[model samples]
Target: MSPIYFSLVTILLSIITITHATTITVVNNCDYTVWAAADPGGGRQLNKGNTWNLNPAPGTKMARIWGRTGCNFDGNGNGNCQTGGCGKLVCNPGNWGTIPKTLFEYTLAQPNNPTDTIDISLIEGFNIPISFSPTSNSGALGGNCRTIRCTADINGQCPQNWRVPGGCKSPCTSQGIGTCGANGDSRFYKQRCPDAYSYPNDDPTSTFSCPSGTNYRLTFCP
Candidate 1:
């Protein structure tokens, strides 16, 4: 092959490689405003029935998304939220959402694997109902690439000792415990949301994977 032809082929392949980043769409189905927050994309407030889309770099392996409710932010992006508050409009530079919130977690394309890990976690306790689903056109890689959710109203059913201002506190968290491995507290969450991570050690069936290029749609209050 000619030198110029080889150089052109190399450039084309690089373009394809750089364009393989994943796209995530967050939709708010609640009747109230929800502040959607993510590590890479920062935060945005979504009024009822609104949506926000984000595209993270291909090398971004780990990320978490959640919603902050009852927020009162000013023009300067400083305010307090009832749940999952990050303290700013754009939560960056070491700001992460508060506890007692439903989380949509992700592990994008790794070095040796072409599949992405995705899950809905309730180990932190739940404030709102959330769900994760692949886009209709997304070519799922494994049989486990199905929608996962925690639609229960955990806050309402939370034990009196585990109740918080606007969220439900995990029994372990309420009792100042760590790593509830097969304990009664962990069992409570597992029984409610069997597909979610009830504690740190809850794996196997909690984690799920899809093809690297698959797009995902995450819904709040769904």
Candidate 2:
């Protein structure tokens, strides 16, 4: 190919790369307001029945999203939350707020791998009941993404040591507890929501994936 034609092809490819996007919609299904937070993205105040759509850079990996309850932010989006606060209404890039937080983690599709990996994580702890799942298109495109959720009233059931204002603390975060799969506390979470990560190394059964460009819905209190 000639130099001019090669340059044109390169520009076309770059445009295509930049234009391709994936979306993760955050929905609040609880009866109260939730400060929906995300790393690599940001945070949004989602009222009951409201939603916020996040479009992170393609191939974004090792990122997380969670909810903060009992928040009081100023007009400039600065304040604290009773649970899962990062010191501001909008969290800085790559910031996973302090626990107790019910974390939603994921790795979007990469160039070589057209599948997205995701999981619901209680490693930090649990606040609101949450669910993470791919939209209907996953099955339509031959993707096998499955929904993962922790809908039990963890705060009410948590041990006294792990109790927080708006959430439950994981033994893993509060202290160096036993492996999530073996500990009684972790067992409590697992028995209620078997599909989520009770501890950091809880993979195999916790990690899941979907087709490339698949859309996702993260529902709070689902």
Candidate 3:
């Protein structure tokens, strides 16, 4: 083989090798936001199929996924999906409001500033937010989370929007304690009432801290 031909073939092989060596890892669940890894290959929209292109370059994961929940709960962005008054609560308009959908969020814990969302090729598993229904039937003003019930004891009279309407339901109840006490301790508190609103869990002296051995591992922006 001629020296020139040999050189050309070697260069082409190097390029192919480099293109096929990309790899990335994505850790996603149904909690906060929908996260997708930007594959370097730039394939077609594959998230709908749970498939990603070839791995992106190291520190090349960049992209903003829309919040999964509260997509179109309300017709318009008016938070009122109704004509008379029989409208389900729409996505709360304004800055960083609650979403009606349930999802998970994955964040990269690397100590590097990614130029874009695609610059990070890995997800921080420790950063997962298990979004819970904040004040079920009723919506709390703010600084409050949804209430989950284990039984239909209160006839769905928890709060304005907390009542489950039909019957009682239990979701993600076996997490820890319904309400954690201050000093990072645990007490025999009621788990979520069937029809209850925002119960006082953390206040001046009721900071809901994780159990003694548990850590504050949340992925969403606190």
Candidate 4:
């Protein structure tokens, strides 16, 4: 091939590679509507049995997705939510979802590597049941490439002092616990969801990684 032809081919391949994106599907199985919120992708209302598909920018490595309940928004994306409110239809990329909400955390493809980190985190507390799983089975890189969830009805069993209307606050936030070790609240959450991050430092068994190209699905109230 001529030099110019080779250069053009390389450019085209680069464009194609840059355009490729990882798919993330969010599904709602709750009886009521849930405002699905993400840092980079913003927010959207998902009624029961609805699904929202997102393709975040490749540069967006770390992101969080959660559900907000009891929201009232206008056509212009102006509104408030009872939980995880960002005051708009599409949450600002700079804004974070409220605490006492379950979070699906992800670290997308890194430089020169095809591995992606994923986990269901209860460190912010629990508002609803959630599960994170790889949609495709091809990226099973051993150890952490498995489905994880916090399906327990934690709100119903929340301790009186940590109980909130729609969620349960972690004792670390409510009772000023030092860490999530050997504490009643930590024990409560860990016992229910062993695969989730019950505290900030919980990583040995909580974090998991998979091949970057693998698609992901997050289900709410599952």
Candidate 5:
């Protein structure tokens, strides 16, 4: 129970937290190919029924996974995408990609709370419908586990101004993020995909979590 020993033990725990890994299986359920990309994980070609597994380092923040539609990467893995492109096939760590695109964002365990925090963010925009959920059924850290989805046909119903080649631009993407509102176009998005973030500030209803060490599945067009 000595002070010095306690400090050493705390440091060890912190190291463990930072070095651990969490698995996320990114699957493309779309009939077409989806270039799956991730900041901190990189990108891969996911054809129909194909999957890409990502193991993000623990204690990582602002980590995200997204699908790039209508991509044309050459054999060298270089090309842009119609939506959610990060300039190349293999995204640099922390690349947010050229958004106006939907996102599966998460932050794994940290010192404060040893649980994974995740959400489906449409704040950037919505290209493809997405579903994110914990693979485990052991319940979340607090409540019963559940899936978060933005599987509404938003592209078919996107407002004229929000319409893009392969995605629907969020109000924040159309207007400046600071001027984004909860009403107006945002409401249209929220009404359909209530569980996903429709605007820049949607943490209260959109964020979800799971126990530490839980794996996840990310599906496009699901």
Candidate 6:
């Protein structure tokens, strides 16, 4: 071929390679499973056979659904899940009925593998039981936390100064509040406690109760 023709061919090949490279992405399309639990001061009154919102991170692909079962929360104490066992969120056919426990599935877009993250929200239903155990402390309070009401928004639910007393954190104990281990952040721990305790126990403190017929939503970490 002529020298001029060879030069043009090489330039065209180079451009094509660059364009293809630009389109390639590092983060592969993946599927993930997100478990849902009750919100802090809420989610305790729900029946052991209630349905939870398995929220997913935005821009992410939901592949499968799996979790434990039951609700566990203390109706008394510092509003923590101290008990190790009471209720759990698991993959069970009975709770899902015929619909299959799968919350939803989606396809993800190409990612740059950057240190960025996505956020997602989900709405869950509940049967808010009646008369949640109240705290021994004296304080006039009123609110039908019982009653199976629908769900409300949970934006800003997780605050910056929220901490879960002691060194316990997620996977609360039977009492609903779990130990955050040795080196734990008491601030972020409490703010994130509501969602954490909602999984195992339906009650935390006697003062903080879930009336039957109320539903709640919460933001959880992925």
Higher lDDT: candidate 3 or 6?
A: 3
Off by over 4 Å in 6: 1-90, 93-141, 144-188, 191-207, 215-222
Per-candidate local distance difference test: 0.83, 0.84, 0.25, 0.83, 0.85, 0.24
Best by TM-score: 1
Task: Report the C-alpha lDDT of model 4 over 38-117, residue by residue, as the tens digit.
Answer: 98888888999999998876645669899998889888999988777888989998787677888888888778756787
Off by over 4 Å in 2: 1-20, 140-143, 177-181
**Candidate 1 lDDT, tens digit per residue, 1-222?**
999999999999888775566789999999989999998889999998999998987867678898999899999999889999988877884576788888888988788987788888887778889888888434455568878888887888788877889898876565554645668877777888888988876779799888776788899988
User: RMSD for each model, in Å, please?
Assistant: 2.4, 2.8, 16.0, 2.6, 4.1, 21.3
**Candidate 4 weakest lDDT stretch, 10 residues:** 174-183
Q: Which stretches of candidate 3 lie over 4 Å from their true place?
A: 1-20, 25-49, 58-68, 72-222
Clashes of each: 0, 0, 28, 1, 0, 67
lDDT of 5 by residue, 148-170 (tens): 89998999999897888988888
The residue pairs in collision within model 1 are none
Range of the 10 consecutive residues with the lowest summed lDDT in candidate 3? 117-126
Worst 10 residues of 1 by lDDT: 171-180
lDDT of 3 at 197: 21
Q: List the residue pairs that clash in candidate 5.
A: none
TM-score of each: 0.90, 0.88, 0.22, 0.89, 0.88, 0.20
Q: Sort the predicted structures by lDDT, highest score first.
A: 5, 2, 4, 1, 3, 6
Task: Indicate the TM-score of model 1.
Answer: 0.90
Model 2 weakest 10-residue run by lDDT? 135-144
Candidate 1 local accuracy as lDDT? 0.83
Best by lDDT: 5
* Candidate 2: clashing residue pairs, number: 0
Indicate the residue-level lDDT of 155 in model 6: 21
